[model samples]
Target: MKDKKPRVAIQGIRASFHEEAAFIHFGEDIQTIECSSFKQTFEALQNKEADYVVMAIENSIAGSILPNYSLMMSYNFPVVGEVYLPIQLHLLALPGVKFEDVKYVTSHPIAIRQCIDFFDEYPHLKVVESSDTAACAKRIREEELTDTVAIANTLAAKLYGLDIMERRIESNKKNFTRFLILTHHENVEKKDIDKASLCFQVSNQVGALAKVLQIFAEQNINMSKIQSMPVLGKRNEYNFYVDVEWDNTKQYDTAIRQVLKYTHNFNILGEYQRHEDEFVQNEREQKFRAQEKITRKYINVKKIVK
Candidate 1:
């Protein structure tokens, strides 16, 4: 007997980019279950209906997705992996509809904001929010509204059989969304190329946050990103979420121990190997080379002056 494919849960419709990321992470052979909302997606995993869930936690244009962070604390799911997808917003509408005919636009709220410059040109056009980008495209196809358009991705337009009125409609060309691949199991093996995400709350004291960060500085751990979110049920309290890249050669153990010594509440969200994609790898390499060049130039100028 053949084994069944792993079932992954995604928070959106069939043509949603979350679905695309899921396929990219888990491969096409994996089965996918679509949920209408992030809550539903978490529930699907909790109920054992799906083996894993994929959800977007942040976007380059919009910053952190606070609701997902709250959900992460509420749920017991572990983030097993992460993937970044470039977001390209497209203006999609029914066939034969011209751009000038668009009187109303529909899309996820973030998508609407991402294309604010384009929408601002037509002050008379009404903007409506949908649950998701692909969901808006589906509505445009289902209702066959000639005057209404959906601002979504090109993939969504193709999947819903809608015509693209405009391509690359986003306000920024470098927009990207970062998603977390979550699972019920927390026992995944940590790899050598692992990045660790942690969340903690520092006591409300002077230099508390600084002292916590100083531990990483002493250990030479490079922090990739850090953000603070308000703590629920506690007035005037905030928790910090941090992502750090550490050397896996036992040196990280000292850093980890030092971090735990300073912070009160600490949770290791996940330590997983970063995704291997040409675009991301190339970007990292380019950044390192640029920094190296700057350092070498500084040293050369200092020597010349001396």
Candidate 2:
């Protein structure tokens, strides 16, 4: 008999970017449990419906996902790993439908915002917001709507048999989303760990927060991210969530031990391996991406009329 594939939970349907991240982190052979929202994905994990969860924590274009940060505080799930997915947005339409036939373009709010520059050039094309990017593509296929186009990934285009009306439509070509892999099972050993996510609160004193930061600095720990969230009922109190990376495990251990004395409600959310993205490797990867020169049908037309 064959071993069972790991069940992963994501915040969107198949062919969605969430699923793409899961496939990138885990193998393509895993089962995906589609979820409607970020909270539902965490609930699925708590209910034992999934072996792990892949959630978008931040994006280069959209910044932090605050609600998901609250969920992390509520559930306190262990983030065993992280995945970075390049957010490549494209316009997709039916096979026979041309650029002139598209009146309305729909996609997720964040995805639509990323393509604002593209849409600004065509003021006549009505931009509509939807729940999910892939869902918009799926709807057009299932409903056989020829007048609608979807801003989605290449996977959705291939899956729904839609033509790529426009390629690389996003405002920023280098934009990518960082996803955290939360799971109940952690197989990582102590010595192998070099990254950690921690949450704590400090006093209102002038140097209260600085004192803790100084500890990590002296120990040579790299603080990658630091975000603050207000306490629900408290006025001035806030929870500070920090992600730290270190080359030497002993330095991190010494830093964390010293940090405990300077903070309140200090919680180690999880300790896992850090995922670093390679910005440029070769000449082709470092080149500026030009969309106007691309072979899209709209490039030929001077202006798009509604």
Candidate 3:
């Protein structure tokens, strides 16, 4: 019998960066399902209509996507992997339309913000928000709005067959977005791995957070990312989401246990290897070498006993 291809759910229509992240993480063999909103994407996975969900977690320019962070805590899905993509915003319109003909522009809020400087120059242009950048492009194409432009990615422009009136319109050239690949199953094995993400809440006492962090410092564990979000159940209480490189040795287990001693709210979201093509693997390799040194020291003591 032939096995079914995995279906990955992502927020937004075709040509969305979320879909690109899904393709990067799962490859081309898998099927992709698009949802209009993040909630719908989560629901698709929760209902077992999709095998996995790819969601954007943060942007280099705008920082964390707060709503998605809250969604992460509320949802039952676990983040199994991550992907980072460089973002290049473009201004697109119908082929015959010139930049001067643009009277209004539409895009996702984040996209509009990224290109604020460009839009600001055109004081006559009205900026409107849409559900997504790709959706804005689709709307322009469907409505045949020659006077309206959309701020979107190059992929979106290509998908909708719109001409790029302006390219790389984002204020910053180093824009990037981080995405998480989530799954309902927890026991999924990770191969060729390096990074791991966990969620934990520390005691309210002073230095409690410091003590938890010191475990990683003492064990030489390298933390790549960390962000805090308020815990919904308790007033003013907060929890943190952290990403660390996975060392082949058992130091991760030790460090996690040490953090648990000071904080009761600890959850292992996922432990997977970094994407090979990115520089993340190089950073992980350095941490893995540090773990190797610790392993060698333990091995040398056993040799002395013999």
**Compared with the true structure, what per-residue lDDT tens digits does model 3 show for residues 1-306?**
027778889899888888877778877677889899999998998898998889998898988887887777778577778888878988899889988878889989988888878977888998888888888899999999988998888788888999998889999987878898888874366676667888888878889889988999887788888998888779868989888875644787788778889887788877776655545455458887998999999999999999
Better lDDT candidate (1, 2):
2
Judging by TM-score against the true structure, name the best candidate. 1
Against the unseen true structure, what C-alpha lDDT does each candidate score? 0.84, 0.87, 0.83
Ranking by TM-score: 1, 2, 3
By lDDT, the candidates rank as: 2, 1, 3
Cα lDDT of candidate 1 equals: 0.84
- State TM-scores per candidate: 0.92, 0.89, 0.87
Candidate 2 TM-score over all chains jointly: 0.89
What is the lDDT, from 0 to 100, of the residue 173 in candidate 1?
85
Q: List, residue by residue over 1-306, the lDDT tens digit for candidate 2.
A: 037888999998999999999988887999999999999999999999988889999998989998888898898788888887889999999888989877999999999988889989999999889989999999999999899999999999999999998899999988899899898744334446778989999998899999999999999897988999998999999999999988898899899899999999999888887765674233224342434345354645635542
Quote the RMSD, in angstroms, for model 1: 2.2
Using TM-score as the yardstick, the better of models 1 and 3 is 1
Number of the top-ranking candidate, with lDDT as the measure: 2
Model 2 pairs in collision: none
